[model samples]
Target: MTAICIKCGAKKSFPYNKCGECAFDPQLAREDLVKSVCLSSGRYGSQFEKEKYDDELNSYSAQLRSGLSVEYDQEEIERLDMQLTEVEELDDKPIFKYLLRVFLPGILLLLFLIGVLVVLKWR
Candidate 1:
């Protein structure tokens, strides 16, 4: 079956593995481009030029990762973070102070009342 591009609504065939135009998936192409860039990273003239190339490559890589994330998946994040040089681990602890803000007090009061009634009945 021919797969259609959901974003652009373009009909595409995979007989030879891609559409002839637009290239459709920016994310997939970005991977190949990164590999070629990394291979040529040390070929720059000056230290400044090398740093500039590396910075631009890093930004492009970040953009590629962000752009490709169409869904939130914890396992996918852990997998990606395992190999990435830069990733901040987020704190998972709850921010709110746990005040007894609901029915706990009411439940305790009812329990006390029931106990008092049972004690009076025993007398």
Candidate 2:
């Protein structure tokens, strides 16, 4: 069987990674994976690139969990996992969501009740 090189589209032998043109090394790839995970936003050049890197990591993790023949350094994988968790935690929802969804509705309801009471007092 054959697998497409991650760096290049060339089809190559499975478990080998990369093609003759790309000259990919497993250790170097592992280092890059760790770097990609450790860097903050835009480290890969743009938000799209960063998301692509995350998607690649997630896909590889799924492959490993699915028992694919592909292999990577276990230590590197562990480090990547930790870095991903940290990044996710840092991406918590913005405060605007709370203000828009919860605070605004409550504030509007309070104003409506106040208006009703003012009309009753006038009567």
Choose the strongest candidate by TM-score.
2
- For model 1 the local lDDT of residue 71 reads 27
TM-score (C-alpha, index-matched) for candidate 1: 0.25
How many angstroms is residue 23 displaced in model 1 relative to the true structure, after the best TM-score fit? 15
Q: For model 1, how big is the CA root-mean-square deviation?
A: 14.1
Q: Summarize candidate 1's per-residue lDDT along 1-123 as a digit string, tens digits.
A: 233232232344421234334454523553422222232233344877766655554544344444442222445344443433232222222222223436668879999999999999999
Query: What would the TM-scores of all predictions be?
Result: 0.25, 0.26
User: Model 2, range 1-123, lDDT digits (tens) per residue?
Assistant: 323444433334442343465675433655544533332222345667666655555565456445563455567557666765687567775666766897888899999999999999999
